[model samples]
Target chain A: MRLDKRAGLSPERCFNRPGLMKTDYRSRERRRRAAWIAFLIVPPMAMMLTFVVWPLLVALSSAFYRWEGMAQGEFVGLQNFSDVLFGDHFAALTWRAFRHNLFVFFALFVVQNTAGFLLAWFIYREPFGFRFHRIAIFMPVILSTVLVGFLWKLFLDPNFGLINQLLEMIGLGGLRQPWLGQETTALPALVMANAWHWVGFPALVYLAGMQRIPREILEAAKLDGCSGWQMLTRVVWPLVAPSTTITLTLLFIGAFNWFELPYIMAGLDGSPYGSTDVLGLYFYRTAFGNQSGGLQDFGHGNALAVLMFMFIAVVATLITQYLRRREIAL
Target chain B: MTAKAQSPDPLFPRSSPGSLIAAALLVGNSVLMLYPIVIMVFSAFKTTGEIFDAPFSIPDFTYVANFTRIWGETSLPGYFINSVIITGSSLALILLLGTMGAYALARYDFPGNSAIFMFFLAGLMLPLKLAVIPLFLQMRDFGLLDTRFGLILIYTAMGLPSTIFIMTGFLRTLPTELEEAARIDGASEPRIMLSIMLPLSVPPMVISAIQNAVPTWNDFFFPLVFIQTDARKTLPQGLSVFMGEYTTDWGMLFAGLTIAALPLTIIYIVMSRQFIRGMTAGAVK
Candidate 1:
């Protein structure tokens, strides 16, 4: 019936003769539907085209040009890209930020995703007070990243902070170095705070996936004398491949887009000797100068932005495709 | 099936050591999660000196000095009002324009139907911040810089893709009988959409609202870039500035942070189930 309507063939067409009035009515209805579709779809399409698509194209094109502030200078094909990739000052910063982004991606995968899966597994077991646990775990995920970042920044203060005070009380004061103040621990500390904030998201996703598993399959696995570890690795893990795909893809995008947390916790320059800098901070600093009197260079900034965008897009696509294939195979 | 006779539930073995261990782990994790926010609230009620002396102790509940100072001294209330305006307007546009687009895509089968749908879907993968340079320039040319309306437009564009995505998915699942009946009754298309279909789409609308509201309310990136005036700044950016000024006064800063976070935290607590469902709805399916 839907197909017939789309083809402009009403049910009355079969019984009635091929009359002019019928054709006129059908055409009029078609015109009305067309008008409605245009009216409905045009505004959003225009908005997207104006804001998202247009700027995207501009960013793509502007990267190859010499930009002095906002004004576009003469076209310098790939000069900006070369500078961003291999210049004296920017090359080191670029690689450092890139490495930091990779480090964050892996750290979050190991710490956050693993913790989330474990939490999901616990909830799936339906232990006593699981309902309360579910809500409590996700509490931090709802708060703004700024709030989480500030809260952790305060907690990690070397003096008069919760972590340090607790450490002294428990006779572990020596271990309480400034978490965000040092080079080695700064990035990891930011990652830990982020993990604390977002681990609940993946937990909920994994829980939803786990709940969809047929009970009979689990019962059968148990009846087969599958050990607990074997059951988890062989049965549950493979079944939740799709959920893993979702979580990992989002994690990758989020890792590369790591801005607000690091920005808030460790200042815009990714302070503590630039240990916490990521591509996001780099792009922002390049485009708009920091408090340290760095000059804004839109040319290099656009180049970096383009590179980040392409890298994320390509890797995310590949990750999603690979995981989806794995899901299909499993 | 035969295992059911010996064990009532083979999938979940209760009262085991492993279950006890899992419960303990969960409780520990919950404590780790809740402890910091609790400390923040506690510190908000204490003076800076008191906070330094007893970081862990609960403060006097009657202390309203921090709250009064923040209310009277800072521009946080203005920031809060600005956030309300920006988020509310952005949300309205996101829903209205998103629903219209989704309805058209789901209900109609015009030429380029799939193309337009894919166009919206592509917005999901490309983070808009990458285009900030061009967007900044465009906003300036359009005379929208430093304006709340500019932020609203940006947010609406940012939000519409997901809103349309979720709404379209939900609208497609709805049986077409109601629409068909309305059409047969000679009702206009807008009437059919508003009266018949829109009412049935409350679930997706709510989901989209919550999903979009959190980000719109919490976003500091755009406002930081576009909104230069202190009066126009939203909560996150405003709190960042407040933190900078009152770095020495931990109590006032905590009070400001608490004020920024309290509304959403309360809403989340009250409607946590819906919040979870809304947030995770996109990923689960």
Candidate 2:
């Protein structure tokens, strides 16, 4: 009874007394809340500002000047950006790298997303061992990309590697070549390796979307005499349009930012005559001198970085705006 | 929607020919996906000649020689410890601060909650890879250069957006009456958070934190850039170096890669349900 009374009556006394009890006591409550909000926001935000936001700004500003590791160099207006994009040989290298990135994007779209869309249907059917398949498929996604790079590099080794031996066993031995060491097969090889590492991500995402579809709609479409193909094309595809957008955007972004696989399989220079060079590896090579890129040009590196950011921001905006307009929201 | 009981379709057989095709496809894809991992595991045990000649055959499976060589001679153990430290400390920081920030943003009727929430979301799509140069410079300035502390801070901040984004979505789903009751009982807000919200929202939040942890543990880019010291390298960076030096030693290299991958693969298999649910839980809605 005393505890109940304390709980019930303290607030009444605190509120009814106006000046005496309310101001002194309730002010502390307000102060406590204000302090709580600040306590929560300040720490995480401070870290983001220090690392993510501030450094991005620094990178952007640093592009205008010709800065090295020691003494920041003289401001050269748009010289850095122009040089990285239009300078002798650098522009050719940039375009070649861009094409490789596009190949990565297109290859992922065809290999990963198509497989994902189909598997969502298969997994949705929940056949025997579907649950096990889902778990096992995502296992590689959980491993480090570095490890994936190493494992694939070994697998692609020309002599004793699994690829060559498998080709020989399958009676396709003549088709086998130096997979990661040839211009024709290098980018495609890396693309498949990347797809192996990440294909489950989209598969799961699309599966979740498939799961979220209202059963009533499916049943209604069936009632309307929709065939299997018609149902997939007319109803299910439209419903899962949002998943396609998310998957495609991530794929596109990942393509342009490609680094690890190429870096591991090819060297820092994206060797075999730079057939596998992507923007991320190219920027690193330019910024920090490698065997192919002779000098460390921080100015050109930052300019390339800024240019990549602009390309992403602009292209991402256009893609999302286009996709959002086409999305059939429920 | 399939959450409900399905009508018995007596007219159709359950295992139709089309599904037969799908089952075959599933089996085929599963092999393709697991093929390399199988190679990595078995090749670690097989003799060099056996690995080359009959790569398809299974090894004895009780291999200790390869493991010993890498441990005896290489720096794999040190890299593993560094990975544990970086992942553990960063995961702790992300969950603690990410949860508190998410709770406040979700619960309080603040002035700029929506704006702050948008800021967090925008961080997700922006490429952090592009900022490696300035991040290197900033770490140098703060005297955190080549330290685990530098990598820890970067991982923490880099993870905050998604962590907050997921946790906030989860926190908002919870009913508010419990929080109000706690408040009336004179439980401070942070106390309420610690005593109530954090515990209640842990499934989604920690899942988010684990999502962050997996990448941080496996990540090589940041460590490669910021860490110049050999002793400070994580598993992935160390693996790269080991691969470069031991380019010809397939046995030790396979053992090292298997060691790098084992902890995470075990977790994903054991907690696959929670891992999938936690991941999709954040993104689906």
Candidate 3:
């Protein structure tokens, strides 16, 4: 009774003002909130500004100058961009690299991801071999990309490779061919090897998504006369849509920025008439590699970086926009 | 999905004759995966002539020569040290900052939180190869060029997105009452996070360690870009140069590849279960 009386004290008696008590509490709360927000926002903002935003600005500024690492050169505004977009070697190399990237993207997105999804569906019901199979599939992803490239390179060697030997043993001598050394076969071989390494990752992802479906819902569908095919297409597929979106987005980015496999398999020059010359290798060579080409051109390199960044930013934004709209609120 | 829950227990499920045939065909895929590695490993033991002569056969004699030659002739040990240093430091930083960043985003309701998260997530789509030139310049500017620190920083920044994303999702499921009770006990925020929160975060932390550390250890791109000097090169780059130098020495090249792959394989075997669980959790989220 005494506490209630104290709480019910008139505004004039509390804090010596009519509405001061309420005003003080609210103002204090607002100050606390403002402090919290400031604390939360400052650190990340500063880091991003220094690392991401500043470098981008510097890249843009440097694109106009023919600068070496230490020395500065005459300003060449838009020339670097033009050279990257329209000049000899740059345009062709960029186009070819983009083309190769597109091929890699489609291949991984379709062949690897689809195969992975199917495998996930198949093995979901089998608990006996599931663990072993999962490990076996995921093994390649754990290995370094360089190791993968080397391993495949050894196996794909035309003369003494196990692949050609196996072909000979299987009574198909005609099938023996240079996998990485040949122009026609090099890029495809690299793609297959890459798929071999990465397919497990997507498969594992799809499996996780499949597992998220409630057992009860699946049992009910089964009792309602749903076949495996029907359930997979009609019920299970729709529920794991988010996984599909994430997998596709990641795979798309991975494919476009493909570098390590081609670098190792096709050499830094992307040999066999530059058949495996990807944008990644091309960019690296242009920026750093010095053989017949002149010393490192920081301006052209920066322009290339900026241009690639713009391309990725645009595509990523479009994908995010589309995917965000389609995301099921499960 | 329904088939799993509904199927009656069987000693050998899918025992039908036709299904048995299908199982055999499916199991054939295993041969595709394992046979190549098996052949290569065995071939490393065989002489060059013998490798071709009995390509499918086992080696006639054990050979330590290839192993000796690779370790003796190359700077692989230095590369190994380089890889360990870069991966170790990078993983440490990534986990440290990533956890703190994740905890903040997960627990707090600060303004523009999702926007901040989206900014980190953007790194996932931005491939480092595209930014190699700029990265080189930045490293040079910071005097981190050709150093392990450069590699570590690049990897930490590069890896932040996935680590933070995964860590936040894992952290969100944790009970908020514990944090509230800690706050009520007059514990400061950092104290609560370090003493209370960090202790409860071991499992996901270990999982992230394996996932991120293994890739960083095995990473080739950044090392290839930022590092040029022989002493600073990582195992992958060292192996690349080694392969170039010993192009014709198939045995030594195979040995180098095997040596580079051994540590990861061992680590994977030991923590295979956690790796799978962590991957599933992250991917599903």
Question: In CAPRI terms, where does candidate 1 land?
Answer: medium
TM-score of chain B of each: 0.96, 0.93, 0.89
| Best candidate according to lDDT | 1
* DockQ of predicted model 1: 0.54
- Taken over the whole model, the C-alpha lDDT of each candidate is 0.90, 0.82, 0.75
Sliding window of 10 residues with minimal summed lDDT for model 3 chain A:
A2-11
TM-score of chain A of 2: 0.91
Ranking of predictions according to TM-score = 1, 2, 3
Q: What is the per-residue lDDT of model 2 for residues A1-330, given as tens digits with 9 covering 90 to 100?
A: 435545543767666766766566767768777888989988988988898999899889988998765346999999988888889968999988888888888888988888878876766656656777887777788888889988888888899888998899999999778999899998898888888988788888888888788877887887888765687778888898888877777777778888887888888888898888899999998877786447777778889999999997888778777887778767
Which sections of candidate 2 miss by over 4 Å?
A1-21, A223-225, A291-293, B1-7, B10-13, B279-283
Off by over 4 Å in 3: A1-49, A64-77, A220-227, A290-293, A319-330, B1-13, B16-22, B60-62, B108-115, B279-282
TM of each candidate vs. truth = 0.95, 0.94, 0.86
Colliding pairs, model 2 = none
lDDT per residue as tens, model 1, B1-285: 224324655466668776777888899999998988898999999999998999999899799899998889889999999999999999999999999999999998899999999999998777999999999999999999999999999999999999999999999988989889977765678888998999999989999999999999999899989999999999998999888899889999788888888999999999998899888877997
**DockQ-superior candidate, 1 or 3:** 1
Q: In candidate 1, residue B202 scores what lDDT?
A: 98
Clash pairs for candidate 1: none
Clashing pairs in 3: none
Over A1-330, each residue of candidate 3 has an lDDT whose tens digit, in order, gives 433533434344556655666877667656765665456445544554555556667776888888775365889889988998889968988888888888888877776898788767655655445556767777777888898898888788898887897898889989999988888898888889998888778888888888777777788887898766788889888888877887887787777678889988888788888889877777777777646665676778778877876776678667767876766666
